[model samples]
Target: MPSPFRLRATALTTTALLLSALATGCGDDGGTDEDLTAQKLSWKDCPAPSQAEGGGSAPSPLPDGQRWQCATMKAPLDWNHPKGDTIGIALIRAEASGDPSRRIGSLVFNFGGPGGSGVSTLPAFGTDYDTLRTRYDLVSFDPRGVGRSAGVKCENDQQLDAYFQQDSTPDDAAERTGLLDNTKEFNAACDKNSEKVLPHVRTTDAARDMDLMRQVLGDTKLHYFGISYGTELGGVYAHLFPKNVGRAVFDAVVDPTQTSEQGALGQARGFQLALDNYAEDCTSKIEDCPVGDTPQDVKDRIAKLLKDLDAKPLPGILPRQLTQSAAITGIAQALYSKDFWEFLTEGLEQAYDGDGRILLLLSDSMNGRSENGEYSNIAAAGVAINCSDDKPRYSPGYVEGRLPEFRAASPLFGDFLAWSMVGCTDWAVPGAADHPDVSAPGAPPILVVGNTGDPATPYEGARKMVDALGDGVGVELTYKGQGHGAYGSKDKCVQTAVDGYLLDGKVPASGTICA
Candidate 1:
């Protein structure tokens, strides 16, 4: 829950289980000068989540006997300037429940968001940590410009409140101008407040910090679990430090090979498929469904609601009305997990009754906007990372021309998702090269997991990631499931395969498909 367009688990850090079927053994560390001198982490007793103080998602209570220790690592704000200004990298280590002498080195976890707070998620590892803590220490960190780290602050709670309610889909010239004006204001505020860190929060920068983290933890190589956007970060790390690659898994893959426009268009198609799946399920199961019996009916009803909101916003229980942006955000969030589909049904019911409270709350929850209007910097940092990583694939005129294609991709969500990229046209900084070849040569077998019906990151993206990694470098594990991520779902096959990999460095056979 960060950007309106992206969906991720609220608590689980990028959950990856990899059984490395054919990975080459790890090699010597890429011991550059900086790697040799990386500061050792000084661990201290962990503090309770600061959500009570008005930031971060409130994680579930820690499980019995699970102990958490906190630490800070100092990394160069700019990797290019090794002696330049430093920033604190917040880390949390979940001590292995098994014997210390038998413990493997730390396994670093990243729940994508580019803005997702690893510190916030560390406590909420829930059931998976129970098994993970028996083998290796579970370590997660806030990448620079993320929670606990020096986050990218742009707007206050009030400003973000107004921003989220602004029309996301710009139909005409006036609406487009309003949307662009708000985006410019948002970017300018971020530039003003976070000038020192904004230019350096690229995924590559975080990947560099990961090397330092690996060195500090005294591991010869990095064992990584990265999800969604975290996969992008992990891919960068693998590219930069192939020699240091250990057991790594990238789940719910974001294809590093695709341009930003392709990502958006691809997502539009994925979401439309998910919507169809949801519609089929709802009609068969839920009584009095708001969208009627067929997928076409569902698409029509939702599209009408979005267009109607564009013309006339609906008053919600909160002071802010439910605008098209908020409604779309709410809908996208529910698409992440089937468990939340009932919430979607309830929300649609409320929307039909002219009460926007449920839908508005869903949007806020997805954005990490607190009940009191406080906001996490997830959206701010997410944009920074996204803009810095790659150039936008479409210009304003190009996007306008491609509208028909996007609409074809997703009858309900395509236009809005496609237009979402327009903000990149006025980004504060230039992006890195788009869709560069990323093959971590000399790395162990990297397991890439994909959900067949993933909405945010389509299944094709996962296939693309494997293709980018080349034959034998990356192994593909397919889950015939529905959701943004596959590992945490009820499929015991994935969980068992992951366990096998982490426990014994086993990798599943290539092209292994599990349900």
Candidate 2:
């Protein structure tokens, strides 16, 4: 299963196909000191996305006819030894469209995933931020060890197919052994294929790269729009260079205070809450609920279906079966946004009839698998970055011991998430810290937006992030909405507050609510 923390803004569109395309080759390492900061990027017309970046055609011109430009920024391969070796950080941007007098440098974006390709993602959602583009160059990038920027590689497409299909929620010691063996094999593949880049892909490293990017972009301070794991990255940047932070926003915020195990437990509960909300919304509709008569009935039926799938898998996409793990993943994917609930309803309806294509497609989206059976490096990078940043290496025994607590939090999602805690087993690199440090006493106020119905990062994490970001640093904004993020939900109040802060430097009052 993919990490619960992975958030792709465009994964819900199944019709979108990614063709096989050439991967972006890494640039040569640069020499020391002043030369690096003074490096000028050679921006050009953006090309079709590479296979590792989740292949797709080049971004279309903006509504106003401005073409998206792509470039590579050089940063030290290892921050500890800045003069030693360098790696390229892929970037995409649309220059500010408004008056020259109003231009406010760049507004960098990181759309979570810790593994997502922002070069590809920013184009898909470019229009959503056109208002902000009036005053800032809308920019986003694929962080180190992600897409085109020294992307991490592990397992072939075929290997990944079997890997994701294996029963993640093990039933016995034999099944447990198989799961561990598979995880070890995947980790070994990453070590073999991307050994040079693994140790340098931590969030702190990415934060440092952003500062370098700020210098290269000729900006006095870093202006950012971060979501999900990006929030953690932004917080780290603030901690490292609080005075360098310009106007920024953290949506779908991750809790910086929780350890890996605690984070997983929170996700189990968060996903369960989203599921409950989804079920309630379905049943409350005037139209007769197709899945069940009541919310409990809906959940009970889903539990039964999962139990049945554990024994006899349903036929899904060609040559693949919808295993219990895939179904759970598909369900989790749908729960990310309320807009996908109808698909979840349809997927469940199809599964009940012994057809599993829809649900499997959802699973594929969650895993970053393209229609052509090619997968981006999202899973590989997700595991690598997660393993490198998280200090704990959970044993199967440790996971087994915590099953009941996880299950108590979410009966449907507990086992899957609990088992995922062992993802870093036998990792090539040791982790950096117990949890990320986001404390920034001197940073500017960052508008922190939290969706009450977020399935990946729980609602409570918003407050935790605010508290962890230190006094007067994090400005909390609540959106009583559903989805992985509040801004993308198109709530007028939320967008207005964010636009006001980013475009006009008018921060909304702390603890402001948007319903």
| Candidate 2 residue runs with Cα over 4 Å from true position | 14-32
- In Å, residue 479's CA in model 2 sits off its true spot by 0.6
lDDT by residue (362-439, candidate 2, tens digit) is 888888898889999999999988989999888889899999999999999999999999888799999988899899
What are the per-model C-alpha RMSD values against the true structure? 6.1, 4.3
C-alpha positional error of residue 319 in candidate 1 after TM-score superposition, expressed in Å: 0.7
Report the C-alpha displacement of residue 346, candidate 1, in angstroms.
0.5
Tens digits of per-residue lDDT for model 1 on 1-515?
11246644652121110001101112224543563355677888777555411254434435665567888888888878767678889888877778788888888999887678787765665456577778788899889988778888888888989988888778899988898789889888888998888889888789888988888888888999988888888888888888888899999999888887888888889888888899888887756566566767766778888888888888874589999889998888778888767667777777877877767777876676765577777788788787777765346677789899989998788888878777666777888777644677777799899999899889988888888776777899999999888887868998888777876789999789997
Please give the RMSD of candidate 2 to the true structure. Answer: 4.3
Worst 10 residues of 1 by lDDT: 16-25
lDDT of 1 at 444: 78
Candidate 1 clashing pairs, residues 3+ apart or interchain: 17-498, 19-506, 19-507, 20-506, 20-507, 21-507, 23-445
